[model samples]
Target: MKEFHDIAWYVKALSKELPNDIRNPAPQRLLGGLAYIIVIVACIVAMNKFDINLVEKLMFSLVLGFSFASMGLLGHEILHGTVVRTPWLRNLLGGIAFAPLSVSSRLWIKWHNTTHHAHTQDEEKDPDAWISLEQLVKSPKIVRWVYRLPLGFRAFVSFVSLSFTFSMHTMRMFFMYINEFKSKKLVVWLEMLIPWAVWFGLLFYVGFNKWVFMYVIPLLIGNFIVMAYISTNHRLNPLVPINDPLANSLSVTVPKFIDVLNFNFSYHVEHHMFPGINPKHYPLIKAKILEHWPERYFHMSLVKALITLWKTPRVYYKETEFLDPRENTAYDSLGNGLDINNIKFKKLKSV
Candidate 1:
């Protein structure tokens, strides 16, 4: 990884400038959005027009599912400003990308961009932190069992349960808004209700069961794929200290096949470090960064990672250090300290 330390030297010595074309992100956003629309339309047409057997339905479902997953990945890029030049443009595209999936853009922005990014692997503040093997060892037996299950399966279930998941968040935000009168809370309601209304309205007014089946089912499946991809990429890794983004995030050296399937989200660490760079530019940035710090990077194929996680034995935790709400930590938000003690629960109870 010493090579990564030499990045500044290389940049200074080579003094090479990247192409202006590489900086133009609008085209990628347009292309990505178009790809999503085409795939969705194709799936709808197939379901509605063709007299398909179970085998065909299964195959088409997988194809459409993977396509929807890729769409979500592209939508993530837009949210990070990787696919567009303007925030408004990215927001517009992001809204479209999440509409079918029934996710809240506002909630995603808060959880992913704000909380997760700021805290990274901070067990106290980062909701996405890796619960350590030692911590797992001390956990209750049930906690150990749940953590031991294949993360992919857990992710699949979570994806299928998105409607319930976001609905709860929506309700929480609704009450919070009512209590606090914060305008930001209103954005949450708008984000959730508008998509729900549109989807339900279509089902009610159009009377097209095929559209519901084609678009919504595939959308949920795609959401599952995205969740699986994310869990495999990061959750099982050893927890790094909150301050260290490099150690906390994983960077898999995926083959071209997987990269194409995932929209190149495999380079997660590089993505975290240079979030401003678009998804299309991740490969370029990763190559440049790898030239500097190879050892710091971790690469595993998706299949290999999944298999290893499945084969691993359960490790549970009982008690881990968390930011005390009374303490002065960097995680304090708006005079409110992060209350890690509140996180002491056996399992994430299903909503």
Candidate 2:
């Protein structure tokens, strides 16, 4: 069995061919972020005022679900520095976008920007890799059953639970960061307090039931959609070794309509290789990659990918020992030393 370090050379060689100008324009990203917030606000206002019949509410809810889920694509763009030039502005916008969805911008930065991006598909290092069902079979029966759902439905359920999932992960990362600082824990307390403050404020200003109907329900629907979309992006692929990040991730060749709505997140392979690249540039990158390295890329239609995942017999995990500590250290260090300050938007003539 080859050790994990033995695979590092393969990953680096694959990534070396990636194009440089994969990022989107800053102004478009800002507009995209603002558009999501505006759409959410509009939906909330429409829901409150329309006094809609049940059928209408259902339609409204579907729209809300789609819009809310789509925001994840927007949030990702912001994270990549494609949404805005200023880091502070990006953080503020990213926070607002994630707040209703119950994700923390600060925490997402650490896990996504620092951890996942740096370590791509290394199962040991990348939390995004598919865990093998064999491991689940050895565990509790309930765990096995939960892991056995139809791919689409399972992905949908996971999407609905995203807020809770992200919140838990964020809190864990938050404490880890604070522990590193050895700082007093006022920030966590403040985070807890802010929600209550807003909840009570809404309850007092509007009626309690209205608060639940307006904010909580919409947020729940939105989060479900977000999670579903995210799961659709990468979860169904066969697990690869921790060192083989590219293989662990797959891309969906979505139709233009869904692509527009998803902000091109279906281009998963391209996104992973050049995360700093904006969604706006994804299609261009995809075209270029296909033109250059068609055989190397996995290009499946969205429906096909979902069907493939649905039919997959089992999620496989490749277990390999790492003989070269230096290689692991090198991959880990690549993302740790990111020059976040210099990750600003710059115009590139071509891919």
Candidate 3:
């Protein structure tokens, strides 16, 4: 296994090799932002203007989900301040981009930038951290069944799980801060409310079926796609104490189309290592990583990786193993079998 020193030395070398033009250009940001807006508007205009049938609307729902996911990922880049220069402009763009998902930029920053980035694989702090075997073992039957669903269903479950988690987390935080009237909290509360207000008003105008087909279903699917990236990115990785991106992060090798749509999220390790680096420069950073680590760096195509995760257990049993707590069996990320029952649980912590 590579130690912290190995990662540190690589990072130092990487910093020296990175080009001065690593930041995204203004034209690229403007064109990309405009394209995203057009796609979103086109989807909405189609739903409103055409007398499309249910089947077609369902198909459109899938497209709409993809569109929203694309926008959400762009918003991620905007929030990172890698897509533009001015801070307020970046925040404004981020708010507009995430409005479709009803996720507040402030709330997302609190959870993602402040918490998850700071403690990527720490089970106790990172909300996206690995699930613990012992916690899954003690979970109720229904909960276990949800986790034990068939591969295809399990993939869907992973997506929907994130949708519910984010929604509930936001609501919990909102209520917890209800009494506080600080300007930032108030702004965040308003930002959180605007999307829902527009949505509910539209629901009254368009009726339930139209709203579901055009908005809700697609929104859920979009959330799922986002969660799909989040879940598979770090699956079966160790819960380490060190802030070594190479050790804890797993980058997915996605196709160009997926990279475009996801704003190069598959280049996750690169993003984590240099948070300020823009998506356009990910390929270059990835090349640098490959030059140094070659065979040691982790990456896989999105679909195959998700399928592997679905087949493998979600509960971490050891450094490179996961336990199917329901069956009391162990498996690697590739679905290879192992006998981990003899493994002591004394050191295992709650998820």
Candidate 4:
């Protein structure tokens, strides 16, 4: 077997064989981003103008929701320098793309681009990383029962939290890192309030009932669309101290239609490999990785990743062992976790 090294070593090797334009921004994708925004706008306008029933309203809301989430990934990409090189233009367009969720582009850069990416799956460091058994013990009892347990009541409906949890986590991270943004607090607050003002203004314009369908319900759907990818992105992978994209990131295959809608964000391992690269080129990156490091790179279907996540305990006892403290049972963190009887309870050495 080849010796493992940091992600940079792999990137350097991959670049030699891949096309030179792989890292270049796809500005044309910005038109697609604008189209997504138009979808959100059209949905809201039609909801207010037409005498649509609840069923019709909901159908429109679903479309709006997907557009909101889809634009979100475009914002995520632009923030990563995927499309625009000019910092001002990048942040401007990125902020617009993220406006539906009222997420601040600047804060996203600090929270997601800087911290989360820097510490992909470090238990102590990655804020989005799942809890450890020791930490789970410290949490409240109700949380232990109701939160994302691999095989309990949580398994049934905790998935819905994805609808709003991504934005909630984003807001929480802002206050959580208040100290770091203290100097630039004004810009941060201004950016946050600007998008929120437009949204809230629409709430009054549309009135409460219409606003629910227009903004609130659609945002929830949007959150669900975005969080589906987020939940499957790194949470299923084993936590690692060393930053190894191949070992720590799992890229799942979605149908081509879904992939196109989300800007190929499913090529998550590729995104981690080159955060600054255009995702339009992600398929090529995937080919190179599979060609050179098939043994180390992890790939699975999106459905399987979601199923494995639903069945596995969220708290890790060891790097590879997931523990549900109530039963003192250890399930394989990276494997199918459906059958409790098949679970091996011993703690394996962190590999």
In model 4, the Cα lDDT at residue 208 comes to 95
Q: Model 2: per-residue lDDT, tens digit, 1-351?
A: 222232345435544555554343455655655776687678667776666666666666666656666776577667677777587777667766555554556556766777776776555566554454345547687766765555456646654466555445556666656444234345434544464576567667767655555566555666654544455555543334453434545677666887877777777776766676677776766666667556555556666654443333234423211111111111011122212123212232321
Candidate 4: tens digits of C-alpha lDDT, residues 199-225: 899988989999998889999999988
Candidate 3 is scored at a TM of: 0.84
Clashing residue pairs, backbone N/CA/C < 3 A, model 4: none
Q: Higher-TM-score candidate among 2 and 4?
A: 4
Candidate 4: where are CA atoms >4 Å away? 1-3, 140-150, 335-351
Each prediction's Cα lDDT score?
0.57, 0.55, 0.71, 0.81
Ranking, lDDT, top scorer first:
4, 3, 1, 2
lDDT of 3 by residue, 6-66 (tens): 3456567888888777755433765665787787678777887899988889888898888
**What RMSD does model 3 have?**
4.8
TM-score of every model versus the real structure = 0.70, 0.70, 0.84, 0.92
Between candidates 2 and 4, which one is better according to lDDT? 4
Error of 2 at 55 (Å): 2.2
Candidate with the larger lDDT of 1 and 4 = 4
Candidate 2 lands at a TM-score of 0.70
